[model samples]
Target: MDELDLKYALEAILFASGESVALQALARAIEKTPSETRELLRELMEDYDRGMRGLRIMQMENRYQMLTRNEYFPYIRNIVKATPASSLSQAALETLSIVAYRQPVTRADIEYIRGVQSSSSLDLLVDRGFVRIAGKLDAPGRPVTYETTPEFLKLMDITSISEMPKFEEFSGGIQLRLEEQPEENGQQ
Candidate 1:
């Protein structure tokens, strides 16, 4: 297909899916090599960004998704009569941070780090699609492990976990000291 046709085909796929489209899938659909498809996606993304358009394309890892720019959310919400998105609570945010950084982590590990029970916060994160059960740990009893989802990346406006700010960059004021807890046998 011609360049313009290829671009329009990609745009149509993105708009119709309304979800992240894998690079490979896009390439297959457009009958182009992955590199060529990536270049095309880059061009499309730049076109959207350079223009005063309400829509934007987000690249998450090897996937691309078309979405409305955050700046237009207020107007869209007004028109759609959608309730304002709720902000995460401090506990939930902390829980999410822990999961994002230390996944696949278990509930015990999270509670140990926060020095507080995090069941409710974890549940809320799961319910909101920000966190998911990656698998069960290999330790005794096989505790379920959690990890951040693509939705988490989307909320953070990041393409991948590697794009997250280095922990040391923001760790100066934070200190975590693990205290020994007595076991059921009363041994610490």
Candidate 2:
């Protein structure tokens, strides 16, 4: 297709996709080689900039998503139906991180790391899309286990759970120290 046709095609795909679309996926959908698709996308992005449009194509991780310029968010928020404000608390985030990195884990296991009862926090994470019930463990009670969802990967901008950073990568923080604080003080 010609340049204008290619621009329209790219814009349609980007706007239609609610989630970030990988370049490979975009190329396949448009029947173009990856290099050709990349060139077309770059041109389209430049056109948006040159025209001073409020929307832009953004690369996050290995995929692309269309986003309105930050300066325009206030105006857009006024006109559009607002998405519900959803956020995980610090406690919920910690529980999510543990389950995300150590998938197919049990509640008791999560409580061990957190050093506190985590049933409520786990319920909250499950209520959100971040965590999911994986299966029953093979041990005694056959308790249910949990794992991170693709939604979790999308939120974290990661392609896979394996890409999550190792716990040692986070070991030096005050947060990490706090995990073992009760243990060090001879408390359960």
TM-score of 1: 0.86
Q: Residue 9 in model 1: shift from native, Å?
A: 0.9
Residue 179 of model 1, lDDT score: 50
- What are the lDDT figures for the candidates, one per model? 0.87, 0.76
lDDT per residue (tens digit) for residues 1-188 in model 2:
77689778989999999667888998998889888888888888787778668987765444677767666777878999776457788889889877866777899999998998999999988887778999999999899999876667667655555566655556545464445432221011
Q: Which candidate has the highest lDDT of all?
A: 1
Model 2, total clashes: 0
Q: List the candidate 1 regions with Cα displacement exceeding 4 Å.
A: 173-188
Per-residue alpha-carbon lDDT of model 1 for 65-122, expressed as tens digits? 9999988889999889888789999999999988887888899999999999999999
The 10-residue segment of model 1 with minimum total lDDT is 179-188
C-alpha RMSD between model 1 and the true structure: 6.5
Candidate 1 at 150: error in angstroms?
Answer: 1.1
TM-score of each: 0.86, 0.58
